[model samples]
Target chain A: MQRPYNFSAGPAAMPVEVLQQAAAEMLDWHGSGMSVMEMSHRGKEFMSIIETAEADLRELLAVPPNFRILFMQGGGLGENAIVPLNLSRGGVVDFVVTGSWSQKSFKEARKFCDPHLAASNEADCHTRLPAPGSWQLSPDAQYVHLCSNETIHGVELHELPDLKALGSNAPLVIDFSSHVASRTVDWRRVGLAFGGAQKNLGPAGVTLVVVREDLLGHALSICPSAFDYKTVADNGSMYNTPPTYGIYMAGLTFQWLKRQSEGNLRGIAAMEHRNMAKAELLYGFIDQSSFYVNKVATDCRSRMNVPFFLRDESRNEAFLAGAKAAGLLQLKGHKSVGGMRASLYNAMPLEGVQALVAYMRDFEQKLA
Target chain B: MQRPYNFSAGPAAMPVEVLQQAAAEMLDWHGSGMSVMEMSHRGKEFMSIIETAEADLRELLAVPPNFRILFMQGGGLGENAIVPLNLSRGGVVDFVVTGSWSQKSFKEARKFCDPHLAASNEADCHTRLPAPGSWQLSPDAQYVHLCSNETIHGVELHELPDLKALGSNAPLVIDFSSHVASRTVDWRRVGLAFGGAQKNLGPAGVTLVVVREDLLGHALSICPSAFDYKTVADNGSMYNTPPTYGIYMAGLTFQWLKRQSEGNLRGIAAMEHRNMAKAELLYGFIDQSSFYVNKVATDCRSRMNVPFFLRDESRNEAFLAGAKAAGLLQLKGHKSVGGMRASLYNAMPLEGVQALVAYMRDFEQKLA
Candidate 1:
């Protein structure tokens, strides 16, 4: 049976194989006579599960040994507050507002620190990226934060900026929620990277944080102990029951990513290659058609979430109904941006994008 | 095929039926063609899920209309800081420390508020409850906090204290993580009740917060917006992505609880009767035996978690091994307290506890 290709921004689709494996092991995980959800966090079984998950995630991301991987709760919005609480230290912080997510982060940080907007693409309607060289970095800023990929506006930073070259000593923090594990990350340029697992990882309950060791112990006194980077690292993310089942599912996804192969490339490399191909196919079709147009600049277009609009806005409902009939689901754009969005995350195959393009062409022909 | 009887304290055993239903629906839920984990939290499918779960839980607990049930993350320990951040108003808060859980709560809250120890059972090594009358009610205290059931020390408050009756009008905040849904709560006496769903509800990621409507919005500026009670309540727990799959599993558990029957009783009342019977059988055996003993006072003993010790310390390993071989699992006590614990949660049938008692008897006789 063919499954529908889901296009929701997030809590998004997961690998079919992972879902099947989890179903098979739902009652008894490896003869333990308990589901993964039923095992105690401190039990040897769950300990192994979390340990393996951390190890696999580290391997997939090529996370440096100096970085600690902590599994936590609360999505990106929660981290918007938690980040400032831990890193802000009631001092000045720098932000590069590229889209809706960074705008939120900027607003939330005001509660904990002096947040300054270093650069913004709002003047360009978030269709282009603000040049890193143009950013006015604070000399004593604790960290410079940005969303690596904006799910809403379909804009992505293909390469991270080197803060040292930009004359800033502050560490770079990236909210990688939308595109983590979809490609390789340059950890050398990062002080911390956090993402909600719902988008590209596994489920909605868990948030993954990879922070540098030196950046760990500086959490402000007001930070919740469970969210204190130093405390979470010290307890191995077990400081407050670390979303056991979500961690388990993320572990499965990491294993799935490891097994992915494309020609000579494998693992994250293979995924990146496949993602590029899928993005190219969909975006190419949209750009060539007069009926469909993506507003984001070509150089900064997101390789994961592709947002486009129909020239004939009157056919929005009809397009969605036809898409659903063709098993292309959740194609509606965010309310704030009225159009259509197709998020091609790690789980979305090349064929799914092909099917979407095919459906779009067929719909346009019918209208003609 | 026989399944092992698991006694893990939290992240404990779920009803086999719930697990089976979750497994069967793992790939597609109600013809939605998407796993619960894959559905968007804002989508109609997940909205229905969270709504139904809240309604069912409220119905089961007979929750007053004035109380808002907020599905959150970060567990009970997370609530330690969250509770004070939202309610303490940076002023004095009183605590009645009964065991290890409440002790942790007291320590974490000091970071956010002026925490006063109104009463403590630590002098008795958490074996008994401090009488409500003996509590030093603070005239200007924001709220008085206590753990309804201490999972580690096996101490429980059978009845919630009325602060007004105790000559204090401060709201009573109870951490009922271990005993929620196991028995009915007197909402009239509670200002707020919070619990990690891992214990009696479902999984670890989702924390259930049933708060009085009037207590909705007093979050400290430092509180993470995702965790602010008012922000969460106003957004219907969608201020951030909620633990979607956990909420769904909790919904299944609520249904399972509703279907429970014991003699003439039904639902939570039925589970309470069965829980009482299970506790009596196990505690009766331990109290009557020469080889085993429970240290908690009889009047305050936990019906959910019963911790006991082997009279002969040398037989601890043997007892645990034998229990495992006899299809009994996770009977080891928390490391802080050296002994054994058999948590008879809502999922543990009366037969599981009976089997545990039978195994203890046979082990004791063999040693003799």
Candidate 2:
């Protein structure tokens, strides 16, 4: 079967190996005479699947014991409400809008709390993160919120802000939707991080919420039990019936991540290395070509999602068609910002980036 | 591979054929060169998947043009809060609680509005639905709610009540989680019908909401945009990135249902016939046996979930083990209501029921 390199910014590509393994096990998961989808979430069979997935994820991210990992639904947008409901304490909340995602989060939080804009890059058309030092954090803020990566605008925070260093005692909350699992997270600086799994993990429904334990019990009285962090943690994320099939696929993907090897390093260390290589390959090609340009500032550009536009703006359709012919898919950018975006997540191999670069170079030559 | 028949209420069993097909398509769906999980929700490929799934569901349920179909996250419990937030309009709401789910809905709705329990079976341990004539629905009730099938108590409303006939023009909302696609729905009487796909359709994470056009714009000011039906409906359920993989699987299951035939009867008609036969075979065996008892009222017993108690409660372990050995699995009832529960949803075939019956008889004979 002719398979293409997919670079869509989420519900994005997953490891092909993970999919193959899942397919092989779909009829009977590990010889249990039931598909993982068919097994009870409470049954030992499914419990094992969940446990391993969580454990592998913990190891990959080096998650601290004081934090809880929750598999949730409703993606990052859902969490815009859920985060404030759980953390805002119905008081003041601080937000730093780096791009489209945090802007959305800030707007959503206004419904639940007294949201104060700590910083914003809206004037710059969301092409870069506002420097952490410039954020005007609220002294009474329940938590300080920011987007670590904006999938739509291709802006990323290479290093998370230290809220304590910035004279804010409020826990730092980051919407890390686009780049989770692609690189290491510094839990010391993070009180909570959430992302939709569609980007770097598995699917749309299974969202990952990693929050510090101390921040768990403060959900608003208006919060639904299913969306309440304390209830979900206490129930082992089964306060409501979870997205079981998505969890299963994610578990397989986790196992695949653990088994990945690159020379002396393995697992996420290898993943980080590979992601760096893929990002460099694509970004290098873009920088070298006069026919293409990426708009993000150099210091904070996302390594996962790279948005570029053709120099000849009218040739966008032709570029996309040529890329499609070369077995490259989903080159379309966010509609709000008309361009091409190549999202090279943890699942995108260096080889896939090589193929993408090769296609870009060929297309540029034809256009010239 | 050893595979056990799963019978959990929701997040329940999936058809083996569907699982096999999903597995086969997992790596590269229809040679698109990406798993369904990997496709961008907004791309042409995934839009096709979403549209096809929606169309298949619309066809299977014969949902009218005036009704909007929303694919959402959150299970029935989340909907408990979301329903009131969207439909309560700060007015009084009425509930007819025959079982656990509706009771939970009522309690949650109390947080948002003045929810009056119009009718209840708590006095009777929820064995039957309260008669419509006995319901004291509020004159100013914004909406009247009911659980069409209570998964835990195994009680079902075989025919829905007409609220207008009961002197209330309030819309009727039904939670059809356990038996959504197992039988036909009378859309004429239902202003909204919400269900989690885990029971009879596909997996958890995908909740189906069919709401009439009139109920579209009544969301409370504080309702989260993600949970607002009007926002969801207006965006064609793309207000947020939908549970893409779950919808795809549910769509495939819908297609499977469409192709189903038992001597020329197809789709919901065939499912109804099969469901009746399966329910009868198990219930008939329980009725005749001295070692088994089902306490639900005959008129209101759920065809999908059969809760039965072994005459000798001490032999429950032996019964489950013996049943497992005989390839009949997950017959254990819910912990809240102890005993064995055989959830014969749309996916459970007549052969599975026959095997369960034969196993029951064998176990009972051994006891004798």
Candidate 3:
């Protein structure tokens, strides 16, 4: 059966191959009598599954030796409070409000620590990234937080800000949920990075946290033992049953990613090149057309999520209906952002973009 | 292919029918052209999935209308702290420590509230339940906490203690992770009941929280918004990106549970009847045998988790190997309690228990 190209912002599209593999192994994973979901997390079968998943993710992302990859529950929002509870120590923390996600992070941080806004793109209605040099560096900040990519507003940070260069001695933390494996990460500049797996990764339920080793033991006395980074890391993400099925699915995704090759690039590097190409195709078509508008600044536009608006606001429902008829799905934008959004994650093929652009153009011409 | 009988405590076994259905729907669920994993939580497809799951569970458990069912992340361990943060209000809370799970719950709750030990079976090494009349219920306690089924030590509170009858004004909170859906719950006696889906429900990541409407608000100021019961209840468990896939899988399990029947009984009642029969068959066999012994008192023994030891400790390896050879897997006991454990959750059939008993009897004869 021909599956429609799903453009959901999250719980978004996944590689068809990943789904097929998971389906095939859903009953018995690799000759084990039990399904991945039914296996004990501490059992050797599942231990190998989690270990391989963590190792493959580390390799794919080029995660450093100094970092511990802890598989946790609670998505990015949960981490907003958990991060401060672990690292902030009720001290001053700097936040750059890029869009909805980072804005939330700043607010949740207020519960356990003193959060200071360093910069905000809300001044420009989140159409552009706030300049790193313009940020107000907190000299005594425990850590600086920012959303690397805004799924709703379609904003991306092409380059990470250097805290040391910005005259801040604090470690840098980024909520990279929307665009994690789509690009390479520079580990030297980041103290902690967290993302929900529902978007670019395999599935929801399992959260990925890559934190520097030095950041482990600073969790507050009130931190839940399950959410405490030190306990999770010390127990190898098995302090509790570590979302066994989610990890297994993610492991299969990592394997699929490893086999991906584009020219000389492989794995995440390959995904990065393909994602950029897909983004360029959609954005170029929109830029050349008078019927569509993408308001985000060109230099900072997200490569994963491309939010566009039809010139005629009256035609929004028709566009969605037509898009669905053409086998393109989940194109409606977030309620907060009134427009159409097409998330071109790692799994969104270049052909999917071509199909979406074709559908949009045909709809525009038909109305014209 | 014939599958083995798995006996892992939590994340133990599931109905074969559920696994088969999940595998079939992993690619395209109900012709939605997207896996349940790929559907947005707010989208109609997933909304229907969660809503149906919730409704079915409500029917199966006969949950009262005044209670709210929350689909959350972070397992039961996470809830140990979350329950206190939401209910304790930083005041005195009563805990009845029965075994490993309740012990952990007690320790984690200490971080947020003044935990008063109302009752304990630790002196008996968790071999029996503490009598309700003997409990030291605090007059000013905000809530009384206990584990309905202790997975590790093979102890269970068959009948929920009546806090009102005990002259405690506090509400009763029960952690029912290991035996949820296997038996009927007395909602009149329970203020809140929480469990992870890994054992009797579905997968590991999603947690089931049934909280009374009156207990909705009053989270500690330090509580993470994602973990706040009121916030989660208000958002329909979508204040953050919930464990979408886990919920979907659990929804399938609920449907599977609803179809279950035994003689004149149906659903949870049917499960209760079948579980009692299964437990009796295994326990009766153990009682008749000279080579095996179950430590927990018969009145307080868990129907789900039956922990037993061989007459000779030196034959533990031989027994496990022989059981494995006979298609009985993961029968080795928890490291904390050194003996074999057979967890007969709802998914475990009469045949599986019969197979386990047969293996034990044969192993005993061979050694003798």
Provide candidate 2's TM-score on chain A. 0.98
Tens digits of per-residue lDDT for model 3, B1-368: 68988988878788899899999998899998999999999998888988998999999999999999999989999999999999999999999999999999999998999999989999999999999999999999999999999999999888998889999989999999999998999999999999999999988999999999999899999999999999999999999988898888888889888888888899999999999999999999999988999988999989999999998999999999888888899998999998899999998899999999888988898878
Worst 10 residues of 3 chain A by lDDT: A25-34
Predicted candidate 2 versus true structure: per-residue lDDT over A110-165, tens digit per residue = 88999999999988888867888999999999999988988889988999888999
DockQ for the candidates, in order: 0.87, 0.79, 0.88
The best candidate by lDDT is: 1
Over all chains combined, what TM-score does candidate 1 have?
0.99
Model 1 local distance difference test score: 0.95
Clashing pairs in 2: A33-B2, A33-B3, A33-B4
Q: After superposition, how far is residue A197 of candidate 1 from its true place, in Å?
A: 0.4
Candidate 2 RMSD to the real structure: 1.3
Candidate 1 chain B, poorest ten consecutive residues by summed lDDT: B215-224
Residues B85-134, candidate 1: write the lDDT tens digits: 99999999999999999999999998999999999999999999999999
